[model samples]
Target: MSTSPRSTTWRTRAAVAVATLMAALLTPAAAHAAPEESTPVYSYADAIREAVWVDTGLDDDGDGRPDRVAVDIVRPSEPAQQGQRIPVIMDASPYYSCCGRGNESQLKTYDAAGDVVQMPLFYDNYFVPRGYAFVGVDLAGTNRSDGCVDVGGRSDIQSAKAVIDWLNGRARAYTTRTGTSTVQADWTNGATGMIGKSWDGTIANGVAATGVEGLKTIVPISAISSWYDYYFAQGAPLYDSGPDRLSDAVESSGARAKCAAVQRKLVDGAPRTGDRTPLWTERDYVKDAAKVQASVFLTHGMQDLNVRTKNFGQWWDALAENGVARKIWLSQTGHVDPFDFRRGTWVDTLHRWFDHELLGYDNGIDTEPMADIERHPDQWETSSTWPPSDTRTTTLHPARGDRPGVGTLGLTPGTGTESFTDDPRLSETDWAARIDTSTPAKAGFVTAPLTRDLRLSGSSQVTVTATPTTRTAHLSTVLVDLGPDTVRNYADSAEGISTLTNRTCWGESTAGDSACYLATRAKTTGVTATVFSRGWADLGTYASPDKGVPLTPGTAYTLTVDLAATDHVVPAGHRLALIIAGTDKNLIDPPADTPTLTLDLARTSADLPLVGGAPALTRATTGSAATAPSFTPLDSVSAPGPAPRIPRG
Candidate 1:
């Protein structure tokens, strides 16, 4: 064929294009290409909000059929069409339809067809567009799920586990509550990550402890690993009726009679004596920490008197013992969320964490420091590991003859005896008063003014050899930081973030959920002394949490009280005070009769988890005592009260 010059040029161009196309297709990069990262893959407006009832194989409400847990999910509409099998970020909570989630008390808003229009909190609004599914389950009985609210018992844990099973095609799920039409999660990659705070987070811990197949990671903030620790402290009841109150608060089905039998079981199982039973053992995730396959990212407030630092401390220790992959964030705010405390950093870090865990993005989050701790209000520092990795346990013995009502804390134990009567009427505030002034109800021991700053990173143990006048007596101990300072008061709100007039956006917004949330600032309060840690114990239950060992009258016995864990820095010139008293009126129910506690001071000592080299303690100058700083009343300075009934957002 005779070709013109133009025809030859066109033919050459086409041939070159074909060669380039074939070469590109044959390259390894073409086969293993990364997903486009310029913009999010899915549309938030087009997200699906549907319910699936997963069979739990138990008739928890006494019905003949198996109880199916109601799982309300919001995810990208075209995950399968996008050629991406998305993973799930599930938050199975009891608060979806009850007290709500977050600081605004946001509930699940629904559309006309009874579909969930708004999934509470920013999880759905933020992660759904990133090509991930967000599932919010109505744990067994709390919302639209079948069965009773068994608290942290088998039903609660299993109900959430069923949803995980359904995601991995290991359990049965239906499109409707009673519909026979089967629903499969074919679009899901079967890797799930759970995250939540408080009770919602507790569910995550419980589920992960079951060693579920597809659970990839969990971010449990301010969660309880042991329900026994939540309600009782070494046989001392934190509240008079802890389990009963908690069960009543989460039972949202309105048909109380339906779960009356289950409710009674919880109450009966949780005895007032604060002894560990099989019921508590079932709820104790610590016991089953060996089964956890998921990497954990835990966050908790050192000042959280509600859930308390012990919950996280004990859990953290257990996870470490099991050699589980974990990261932690310890804050000064009480029961507060990291999003509120560190806001921008928290959001960015969380996004990276989710991307790494759920989307399989190599974000290098695992290579980063494993622990982030708040040294002061709004001040944070990262460490290679929790408790600073170099923390040392230093023992400080109580010495007498320093001052009445104020004993010296030093390395050498002094000979003498200090007697204090257990007064049922004394509160923590009353014990604070006895620190300087002589009082028969409490014995106070203070370290001399520290020459250098000393930081404590973990729990402190106070062991006292004492003789009680009665067999049963309550021992309340507090670790106090005596220095004039201002700190974030977390005890005021559930999340420790007070709602403000300002609003800030975290991610994209949709018709159902907003990208913006009300701005929050840490509530700050000034104080000369703050209770760094506190622990209560019923002496009768001292020997074992499962057994009561009454003390013989006038017989000296060694009792150890583990104070709440803390991350606090006692500045130079400040003293660390240990207050040993009777019952803390604000926390525990007092014993019937008052008993005198005679402490053998030489045998009494406290072991502190010091973060650095032990600082030298200077003896008090005898010439003239330094005037004490004007102190803000402990009540005036916000301290966490009883546990809030609401879940974290």
Candidate 2:
């Protein structure tokens, strides 16, 4: 109390210095106590293989007993026998007994003794010899698990969570589904990491959002965070019976009657109305992102039309807002795994990541860049953050001349109007077919050739003030690159990979599980115009997705549609085009009646997140119309059809 302020400050600094010195001295000792990496610490031939059933305490099948998730584990025999506690790398999946995993459709192979002889992919073969336990759990109601498939619901998530609990000595497990023998994970250190792709990866995301203990990190590749967004977008139903069809596809039980009730619940819950309700909220991981305690490594394809880029875009933003540590790989391929895209680099990076997170290795991975974006095929660029963290949103208004259906994009407000009639039979390609001509089905607008290259890094927002001739109408907005170019045609391959006769190997291979896979190549397509991004919305749901307010005929209303996010570079001499049309027949249901839409040219504009370009308008009055080039219709090269079906694996 008698000490002066200056003297107190000096004392505090001295105390901090002493504590810092002590920590520095102790850190070296702690680092020395950590395990060292050596070649073949465990023998692959001597790895232990066994199975256990973890109790989730949920009777989703109504058998009066808790659901038991079947887990097949392979670990280092010598270390486990010597009482060494090792970390776990777990992959909980529903495809073990169904369509299988990877391009080869590799399923889990078992010996006559019911012990797992093979695990799909190289996770078990590559990691077990390096001193880690690899466990593959059959998700509830799939494979050997005892329950009904809930399709990312509570039962599905709990089944995986229970295994983590058992590893941490917080839950019960048995040698069999009804066996009296207790099975314990006494050899595990209780630090777990989950990884997978598609539905398998979706389970990892769901469990991580629960904030469960003992989970160190998760790698969700091409995963879904919200089922609602996956099937519907702003009241525009992408597909009918989406959930029901998915549940039916994954359930291995031939007896459909066994889970008829659950199937009915899924159908009733979805409703195909594009509205958020309690059912969707329960399945949305973004709503509970703040509860996540584990770090995340996300991977997705920007050209993935099946799951779409919005899934990763929205989830990544939510994780950032919650202050969660995250890393991402945004690729150009469609729904393809990184292993096939960048084999050598992917394996090396993944190995270091697992070591740092699960084994507590002091690697500098966390200090590296947070995002890797494939600017072009096989050309990747790493950045400190996604969207470049310096992207600017620039709005371009529609400027019209004497043309009735054609317009130009510029900074100045326009005076004329453009109109289009909703056509139910019109596909995305159909709209592009009329880009050079005046058509009633679509209104086309283009910008002058860019003087310099422009890079678009995120989603684009299209705001239109229009009046519908009918009470309700469907609107589709597309951002197109108007120039001749060659790009990957993801629409051809279901998984975005074409299997080649040539085979290449990655990682180590075993007799039971081969690390070699059929080589893959993207299907290349040449076209005069390529759609960079697209969006759809139901006009009636402009105000609220839950309820629709029918618009009065001739009453102007403003609607904003968020286009899918993408990472693309528009080279010089290329023009940007905005095509406004009716329903996209390839993706969604069309309106009941065709409606004519009158667009107010002055109020309609598009906000694009662009980088490395000056904000200048290309007005029709400034002699910029000469810079716009005419192109052959896109349909001349390829016609649009139904959206590509998602690959089973």
Candidate 3:
């Protein structure tokens, strides 16, 4: 048929459009656009839920067979449906059946048929829908796993490492504890990013230190790097107990008989003498930081006496020296999970972190700020690097004041000596409270009020020269900020954040598992005084932590005591005090016969990690700092011992 000119033009346009559509369908870009959903690319409610027993090469229970750890997995259904694979986010925790996980203490629940009905926490609920699998692993010797608890030792680490190996096709996984039917992780892309809190997170650190090839990244929250530092601080025995108690506590469902011998081995290896034995060395992840192939995303509390800030500080330092990619969040809470204190933001940030690290998404997450610090309650600030990347150490000395047991900290060292006898019943709070008064337990020294704000952004130390009246003495030193400020009421029953009745959902949920969680708010209190940092050391370990040499009576020894790491800003017009004390009761077991220590003021000094060094400190204490605005003065936190709770899962 003959067509008009306008009809011919329309026919020609239609032919070109058909050709364009065919070409676009064959393009790689169009293939990627096949899934048009905005994330939630997979179905959480219909995910493939399964379980496996990964065989670890060690048998700590001496059962004459290798131990097999239980791993419960939930991956998106889209992997099998659409023929796509995804990475994994694993939380290998011993608390899966015992004490529970996260703030609400959620545990794994199973169906009547013995299949995993629910996985605890928001990880599976949130990440599974976003094209990630969540694996809740019962660490060997806990839950349904067949082994003994080695605490943070070889068996404990290998239990989780075996899971990573299984994913990478390097190890075998079975359908049952005693079955020969093997299961392969063909649905997974073999990239793992382990994340957890407390003991679970400690395993992540250990596994990463193993230089495992499949682990892409790790998010360790309030984790321990060294078992030695956990039980003792610089040779000062901080706890009366050891790993034996922790190992026994998490061996859920009464399989304790098998682990009894392992517990005894733990106690035997970890002596009360505070010496770093082979047991502590094996548990220490910081030494193997160079072997880590995965990028690290770490979070820790400034006032965390449980896992403590030293663990993060030392581990972060080691990671930095080894040139490992890392990011961090420093909170103000005490021994809390970021999920409880900063839930919504934490979930989102962690999602992005996992996406960028594991999924190989060039999302510019690594190019962003490396550190996020909660300076005050619910207030946060970001930086390119921690300690502002410009920090320097400034030395402040204790000078004698007119009153006995009261002194001043100055740029110049003071002559003469000051003495204080040890007290067995006092905590750091008691000594901090009586800074202005004369006390036999402690000698306090204060600096002139700062004229401007001064930030302390890293670890600090005190070099002390003292002569003991007896054969041995314990030394405890603290840095206190004597001014008004608002701090988290760690004194609160809940430890800083109180849970609210309100709830919010972060992702899609299943019938048995939830993406919703109770809200939490920072419980704050106005305080005139707060302990910024403190440290303790036994005189017997003065020469070295490896050896406990017998101290000579009336003999002088100069030793360096490293304080906990922190990021705190001393406001203008606030005085920084240094307290010299003995036996921070409840923190360390006190000796029956306490010794008196004579401190040579001229030979002692505190090395502070100041953001701007001496010049900034001089400007802050000299000029405009005097008349600066201040907060309302109130009582400080009246807590018991620094760490009254156990740090185990």
Candidate 4:
């Protein structure tokens, strides 16, 4: 349900004052105002009034410059009581305008008797009274602003900064009009944070990297970290041949349609391919990690089919490398799971970060490390640092003669190989199924049952020694829990609907950080959580089974598949199943003709590192049927080896 906007402004003002005073007296300003409402407050709606763009400027050709940028600002109403300089959050989009390539009718479509047109600022009504002033601007050259859209570049960033400065100036002027003690427009003495999702998230990051003095923090949800990878992965455009790509372009154009003249001229030049371009390389958060310094709370869905999960890890890496110590939350879900207004937990967290950074409130946020990772069934773990120390290492070996139920620890070497065909037609949507029905045609691996509750978190690596006939073979790994004869996935509804979603145990990007599969969500299956899954690459066709014989049939080549880090607490008695099939059931699409491949029947073994000092599970226990056992953060686990190598350029 949409939370009813705060009913009264004075009530909100009073609460803010009381809370601010208490915080001033007892705690550091970094503290967050508790959600527990102390009094009725003003709804943000009551604070800002409807206004229209009465001016115009540049709406034109190929040049990127705002002619007469017009913005709609919403501020607290008149009859001001105590001094209150509001913190503002801004948004700007050009979804409706038609002047140059634009049409008057197209650009000026009004709704409900035309009292108010559905302009760019139409959606920011939710940020009011929550202690923020909202601004929505039509990018210059479009609607009311002046200039062509530059997507993610210097123009967008600088223009946003200019508008922010403009807002701060207007806010100061208003304070003078009211005779308040608010400081003249300067920095975040009054505090400011940027909020938005997707496009907005991207802009917010851009703004942060701009190093705007007044900007305090940012809450970018479901944002793109790298346009290059998002549009094109590994130097290849993902949307080039897919129908969804065309559909997305059409949908994206809807916003630009507001400015017909500008849309007609600029749409053609918009980026389409994934090849490295000046714009994409410059716009990448990973490439420009050092530029961002603001406190950020980044969120992403584990199975977001639209944007690659690599964006999240890349952003996290950027922030970590810059030493920003930002907070990250990776849910086991999709694009907009937590975007609902009524579901204010995300907002609540954002507010806390702002309070800590902008307000200097020490409400325990300082104690919170750079990361607040929530992996599963309602459990949140804190890490003083990311990629927590002491990550457990285990292995799964293929089934061989005389060792039907044993793991990979003590398997003998036998010469053999497993091969499957690659069918490109049938592929799984990242969020649709657990198994890639297509890739399984040639992909294969092994799984096992848990001897005890398993808590796999952070980064996982699979090293395989296999010889491929082809120059490049696509190897994939999947971790699953086999229930009896059926395969049960550890993923959840919140993580996503896909058969397998990428998981990040340590602060790393599975999609781009390494060549492996990462589980999207954390799991803690009960006594039934026995079967655990893992696998290796799907050597593409052109190799022995797919094409030419790259490997000598009897040669011993090892292939490794790395699974993403998981935070699962699988129950005892559940058998971990290692399936070594040439195909995956739900992830990658399988190739049409699978070759008959064989694995060495004799030499297969799992070598799990059993820490000498750390005790292993002596007995098995089951969690209650009512509640699944959650894997708690091991606050003090011994480090398994020297810290894993941090990725480098």
Candidate 5:
């Protein structure tokens, strides 16, 4: 059964009125009346629907005229019925007519009149009634849009920016794909907010980085900050092939033929050599973060191997440094939308966010906590900032243990050395399950069971001084929680949330479209160990992530592997461990040749972000370099090809 909308708490509206009165009391001359939306006060049943092709200055496909971006819109009849213009919410995506969007993979369906009958997700159904216009845009070279796909290049970014430009009356739009006459977005008040998940969200980051006018805010979920990092890490490629695969996937059949040249450019300029090229740099939004003027509400799954947590970590840092007002939600799921795992709260909070940013409502959302981190499955906590600003780095070293292959992690420097031969065949699951066993593939180190619950709040770094027998080698460092626990089954195709038969409606419905969507619950399973964070690098590029310096087979190199940002708690009686290995066959693409690496224990250390810092770690210190029960060999565990839980990168 489809759910129906009920009265919302509208938590921030009362605060908005209070703040407005205070502002008026403080500055009587400067204060003006801002619209206060108390509820879904408008009617979605009579919402106006239309489509337009906005003009982008770029001729990416090499056609004579400028490329046009297709935009499908659904807006409450404020301008038509009430004679009032409203703000806009846009999701410019390549997935609109391709892979689809949201948990149900909802696609746009048009009526015989060529107008959109249903827009994917609940944005339109929910927001339109709240006095906001929603537009679903087809990215350049995809769907009904003009020009060829350039992936995340100038063409792609420009297509979306052009829509914002049109909404703000800075660019042109037409009623049809190749229409000569222009159409104006006169009904919009020009304040625009962009939001999406995955590639769609990635475009939000790119567009916001451009600092384009009229873009008031963005909500990017599981988005990418840099194309280079998406495919490679520290001069090591994450996968084979090039960006053309993604570019071709989204383009329509007719457009694919026209986009052949653009696809070729993507292939030719790909970061296949593991070196950041002009192509990758052009798509690097982090470098331009300082120019961002839009407030951001970002979300990412801690276990998303697809886009990776590093993307949000880096982008968030940049936005913070540049003083871009921002809020974040970090979940334990993998590449899943917050709507799936946190439906009701997601809609409520998001409603407040859009009201504050685009609607210019004086909601106290900005005064609230900046980060909402899900430390465990369905367990959420708020902080003033991510990873807690007071977190301190704790350095731990690896030393020989009582067991043959196992080692201990301690507060003091280690005196001995350890060696591990490269094994690209084994996956992370195998390496983690076999930590205590004697193996040439990896070197494992574990700490004693913690006396108190210790939390790792942010990105950790593993510095390794190793002499490899082979000139070309790959290094991978993984941080693991060594204890039995039940966690969201991110390995599942659903990315931790199982869609339920029951439906929940967010807004009004019509004969053709309803705001009802299948509800979801966290899909969890039991596991003895969990890989929380991991980082990789090519030994040849040990000196720098960008440039490769040739390595001598016999010489040692001090390389640092920066793990993805994470928030995890190792409860009392549980343990934490570090594993250094060669290729992670399941996650990273293996190098042609992997050599045995000999590590100088005294020169290697792992820098952990601990909320409790040094004194907190005192109780958890290894009394002696002895084998821990948690480090026992996992010979019984099996690592099948492509370990589950690696999704939504």
Candidate 6:
């Protein structure tokens, strides 16, 4: 075994080369690493192909730098029978491909955060292993992507198309290895669907508009369709004041970042609109509703205070107008909370929908009944169409003065005026923000309490002429049912049935489109309320006050308070109390310097569409009873943490 020094050196170099070659072969490749490849890396019941980022040279908007696109393919681990490829469910999300913050954090519902958190891709993250490939793609301008953010505009549209094309190719590559045929060249050939919530939900609508070659079906859960209602309700900014923040608050990269990127694009080759024009039409979903062709399964929450419940209504209306076959599921609960992901039923429902449409499977999604939760009944109702055709109106009147213990019935006809001075110095706490305002109520008009259990459920409305001292003032009116004993002292009222206390449940606010008429001749707030059936009852005939002593013709009943609505059942044995005022500092958040309101009751009266036969007023037998609902601080109803996964990417 003896050897020369030169021979020994040669042997050492040969050994070193062998070692380096082995190390290179052992290092994991950057391409999506299979779950079982390294140290038994996390295997989410579903097969997952780790995301990989790629560069696209198109500046998209001449932003100098090339935009980067990234995608992750998740497939079922089990082999398919014969030659069937797994169907593809392509979902686009905004996440950092490198940092993994967007992918690993929350899947985007309303959470207490300072930026937008998208959770759609991760929602049911393991669902892909159930024989479908889930593709999560990043748009051109977001994390690792190199194009200017065009919001829901052209850039986003182009990226969506490109992603779809890429997924088609990826699925072909995937099928070759997995022995599946679920994904075909044509999305509609076998099965391919889109799923998302909120902004991600909106993407389905946008892509459908482009007539994308193969977007079979869409499950748009809790998505926003009307920018007007989502941003400004009837020209008024929505009061998104609750602690459960919105997507924009958390997702926006601060206002400064947005301004910088947008400005840079405008200066560089992008078209510049000096003033308001139709240039932003692409970002407006409502205008493009007619172009959406895919069948959609829409879900929304009536009690969704953040995005305004009207968005769902608007979408439903637009889809119908466009002759699109769409189904909706409205709930009284908050956004995405109803899915109950623990049970895995929600995923099944979505899967069934895609299977029926994309795979041409007889999953019977189309034949399945539509479902919704009626607020008051505290039950789910299934129907073939939305907003059940059986919906009817029951109006409760505001009878005052004639009734004794029912308070100096100021809502009586011929009453002169009821005035209240608002002091912003004291300030009002609306939802959570403390802001200065001249008055506490500003969204809707109100009436005196009805001397009975007034059910104010299912699309309630009120009209009043408001003479604001300033240009505008928010008006909120609450119609309360002052039950038996007209006036009784009670307390401890919680949501749900039979959860009672000393105080009786008496009032409900006009939730969605309540209105107010300004004396200044300006278009007042639109008044239309879609009260969830869970809490308040529909308004019906009420007992008029006894016709005892007559009041002076011109005397005024000055009743004052704010009005709002909720999704909780009010118990029986409760008097109907309607307190109308200029501001609802508790439920609604408005800007400071709120205007002062002056309403003359002499000029206000109800255009009630009465339900039951007009009932007669009975004289109080012996003793008189009346318990007015006094002002009590409101209890907050918002939850915080990671957003539940309902297509919020």
Error of 1 at 585 (Å): 2.5
Best candidate (score: lDDT): 3
Record all residue pairs in model 1 with backbone atoms less than 3 Å apart, i.e. clashing.
Answer: 102-649
Error of 4 at 458 (Å): 3.3
Q: Assess candidate 2 and give its lDDT.
A: 0.77
lDDT of each candidate versus the true structure = 0.77, 0.77, 0.82, 0.41, 0.81, 0.39
Please write out the lDDT profile of model 2 over residues 517-543, one tens digit for every residue: 787765566677777788888888878
Ranking by TM-score: 3, 5, 1, 2, 4, 6
| Ten residues in sequence with the least summed lDDT for candidate 4 | 640-649
Candidate 5 residue lDDT tens string, 262-324: 887788887566877788999999999988888889999998877888898889878767767
lDDT over C-alpha atoms for residue 392 of model 4: 42
RMSD of model 5 against the true structure: 5.6
Which regions of candidate 3 deviate over 4 angstroms? Answer: 1-27, 30-38, 624-636, 641-645
**Residue 543 lDDT in candidate 1:** 65
Worst 10 residues of 2 by lDDT: 1-10
lDDT of 1 at 614: 50
- Provide TM-scores for the models: 0.90, 0.90, 0.93, 0.59, 0.92, 0.57
User: Of the pair 1 and 6, which is ahead by lDDT?
Assistant: 1
| TM-score-superior candidate, 4 or 6 | 4
Best by TM-score: 3
Tens-digit lDDT string for candidate 4 (324-353): 646666654444434321134554565556
The per-residue C-alpha lDDT of model 2 at residue 371 equals 84
Which model, 4 or 5, shows the larger TM-score?
Answer: 5
- Give candidate 4's root-mean-square deviation (CA, Å): 13.5
Per-residue lDDT of model 3, residues 1-649, tens digit only? 1132422432343344334433432366564422212278677878888999998988777788788889999988876665556789999998888888877888889987567887888888888888888999998889989998888998889999999999999999999986889999998878899998888899999999999988988999999898888888777788878888888788855458777778888999999888889999999999999898788899998888778788998998888777677889998888888888888789878987776665545445666888999988999998888767689999999989888888988788887888999988888888877788788989998877887888998789998999988876888988988887899886565668999999989888878888888999998988888887878888788888776666788998898888888988888878888998889877776754589999999999999999999888788888544222343334757754455445634
Q: Is candidate 1 or candidate 6 better by TM-score?
A: 1
